[model samples]
Target chain A: MRVLALLDGTPADPDAPLIRVDDLGLLRGDGVFETILVVGGEPRELGPHLDRLARSAAMLDMPEPDLAAFRRAVDLVLGTWSGGPEIAVKLVFTRGVEGGDGTPTGFALGMDISPKVIAQRAGGISAVTLERGIEPGLAERAPWLLLGAKSLSYAVNMAALREAERRGADEVVFTTSSGSVLEGPTSTLVLARGRTLTTPPSTLGILPGTTQAALFRAAERAGWSVEVAPVDVAELYPADGVFLVSSVRKITRVHTLDGKALPDSTGLHTVLDGLYESEY
Target chain B: MRVLALLDGTPADPDAPLIRVDDLGLLRGDGVFETILVVGGEPRELGPHLDRLARSAAMLDMPEPDLAAFRRAVDLVLGTWSGGPEIAVKLVFTRGVEGGDGTPTGFALGMDISPKVIAQRAGGISAVTLERGIEPGLAERAPWLLLGAKSLSYAVNMAALREAERRGADEVVFTTSSGSVLEGPTSTLVLARGRTLTTPPSTLGILPGTTQAALFRAAERAGWSVEVAPVDVAELYPADGVFLVSSVRKITRVHTLDGKALPDSTGLHTVLDGLYESEY
Candidate 1:
């Protein structure tokens, strides 16, 4: 079953035409969105996702989103959702119709998690490093680039995924021009070395991964050391474990890099998986 | 008055809802578009704009757009349009609805040129040089960056324009990290030194400006020299003339750069304007 709700907490027909053609979100991709996982009709990490949505809107110079309205929309959708093991809830906020009033467009949609995403989580994925063409330190200085903002302008990310498909990989791990490992197109990179877990800092202009933060918190309680630092592309090959994490997918191990098999980290994977399950 | 048309050449209500909420064009900015200036109900440079649209689609790995259908839509919109001095015709083709059949979505919208656009063309504009964060030549090697494709993923471009406004400028001239001049967010940079006209080449991964190409053809016919080369940001300050060109705006002189006044080039401007008029 699918459920859709407007920002005002009004339920909408999911199959009907919704957004206007001239909406800036459709015209120029001037929008922000969040994808959250819902288990047993309960949305996970809704607070963080809404916070990120507001942060993204702020970065785009848009007015602050009404978190209460978004929360109502989410609750409305969840109220209508039929029983399901998992659903991916998406929240979208746009700059509204072009040449019209300044009111923004917003929506909430709840749908089943894709089988591929679930399969990837269970069996892991292969990724290839693709140069993002931006220098490592440039994004922090260039605010206009909107580097860390998870806006709807994801054509490059989609293109990178297509490139990964062309290279016979399932996913892409974007790297800076100088070979610093940045993050996945839609996920965060997590590296395990011995008892320590490392993730690249958000200061590198990558999205601060919500799921990764949750996992780090859980792991910390479980006695796993956590570190946020710059990561090098070369370190992936020699790391004790490498994984990609997202809200919907939860956690996915990286089994191969550039067609070469990575060393198995089944023990670490089990530990991380248990940690995530225990907390979430 | 505004006119809207579907790909099948059917007219639609401009005030009505059109695109579905799940359309990938709005969801992920997976789309390509073209804007053509219609003067006296005739679209200027329709052929070149359509060609560029197809090229952009190819770069995005999207299916080749049916140019005949787009042409029909444009004709339909113009036929319905009441008399106007100028109209901007926008054609959009998107990857269709997410999780649906593989058909594409297309539309043509014709609306009046904004007064601000007309005013800018008549009085010129001031621009600030903002670093694009990408290194020079990196775009050529990183095809996934979608540098030249005019995709709907323009949030960064919009953000840069906002940044320009914050700096008390009307427009933004994007520059590479190393200070090589790129193009404007929505236009092409044209520099005049002595009797020669220079524009940065598409090899720099900038869009091959359709208006600039037409201007160059006119310039060549007028016995002026034209050169396509890498331009430095410094050239704008000392050049005999600097201008931004787009299909709708046509030609706009750059009166100031980073708040400093630029030299006036009335003679060159008149010559170029006459040349454009004579040809178009």
Candidate 2:
């Protein structure tokens, strides 16, 4: 797998030493990142992802990233890579080496999406509800907890996925201590009920889903109502359909949640998939 | 300023590209770390730090690290660095590149501890109370959240320290959502009331402090009573004294909490300092 880095403006060798050992991003996970889906050499939802990355940086109080630099790097990478009608492009900004000037270390890398991820999306995924172990309303009051930021500190998310795999499930839907459905490890939760599409609010400490927002707009235009509400984990079992959505995965149907088969909604998946592909 | 990577049993060049971009440690912040203080070319409390690292790795469900390899790396880094009766030694282990066999990527680096940190030990520091935004007992029930483990996913901890710095304080004592005193961002909260030195329990999602444990044993030997109990944020202001203890920092007194002066306890500092130095 080929890679590239944007340590100082233009793309550099990914094989060289690009990061310092004391970089807080590597040491303390003090950073933010966004993953974009590149199809046919065009980055999907670039603006939204960049916007979210900026917001995440702002929340962390790190330097706002050089978006122009990021764009140039992304373009350089996508243009250079030969094998990708579907590539995953990741943009990362870390609070540089500890005790430095705090200038953010920024980089981007493009890789081909795995055949397994693509297959999981096509066949849908079985998910389990795991306890996120955070209260519902605490993040709104304590922003320093970085609940709304897409920080690189995702050890718990990876552990939850490992637990799911141990349980023979493919993915996870994390719920709050109060049992409110939060979001996925690397995706957002979206549920369809009748003619309305709903997602949990970012106010509840979940990162606002960029693709979910785009889908909501498209659904609104497609004669479906869109709502952001507090969704309980129980609501997922009876919904018309449930999806784990993200920029890269696009949208994956949750065929079974916690070993129970969710209602079949292939028709809903088809409609939303078309809307996501075209809208983004 | 030097570093080394024990990628596969040998100390590899730190200047070389030893990590893949897809390394879960870099990609997902999925890893465990230990920061040890080296004095006179020997790692202080090496055994406890390694034990904690193993426990943290287990908590993350990554492969158990090769302790023998780790010791060799530490010895090599310390031997290579010429400076220091005081050096900061770091051990890091990531779950390796994604889509791989989950072999762990391990490395060690030695650097001089900043003079400011050494001074903070003697001059003491002003601190503030920040909400950890987690409940007290949730971590014990939900190990996947990885609260007790010193996982590398510490973005929130860094953010809280930034907030404290923004508020003109040197450190933070994180309280739970319910206002129970938890621990410092990187240190354990230890309070003195009368002759008893008390610390919050690890059951409250706090990382058990290796230094604090050694201090407690030494304190008992030095004729001070030691206890582990639940402490509220309210108790910090009225205590005889309050401190943040860690392996690298040793013990740092909290001169103030949220702009309120904590009672002076120079005698406690002196006693604990002697105990810490001699015990280690």
Per-prediction RMSD in angstroms?
A: 1.0, 1.8
Docking class of 1: high
Q: Where is model 2 more than 4 Å wrong at Cα? A: A5-17, B1-18
Interface RMSD (C-alpha) of each candidate? 0.9, 2.1
* Best candidate (score: TM-score): 1
Clashing pairs in 2: none
lDDT of 1: 0.91
lDDT (CA) for every model shown? 0.91, 0.86
Q: Of the native A-B interface contacts, what share survives in model 1?
A: 0.84
lDDT of candidate 1 over B106-212, digit per residue (tens): 99999999989989888889999999876667778899999999999999999999999999999999998778988999999999998899999888888999989
Q: Model 1, range A145-170, lDDT digits (tens) per residue? A: 88889999999999999999999999
lDDT of 2 by residue, A206-234 (tens): 99998899898889998999999999998
Error of 2 at A251 (Å): 1.8
Q: Provide the TM-score, chain A, model 2.
A: 0.97
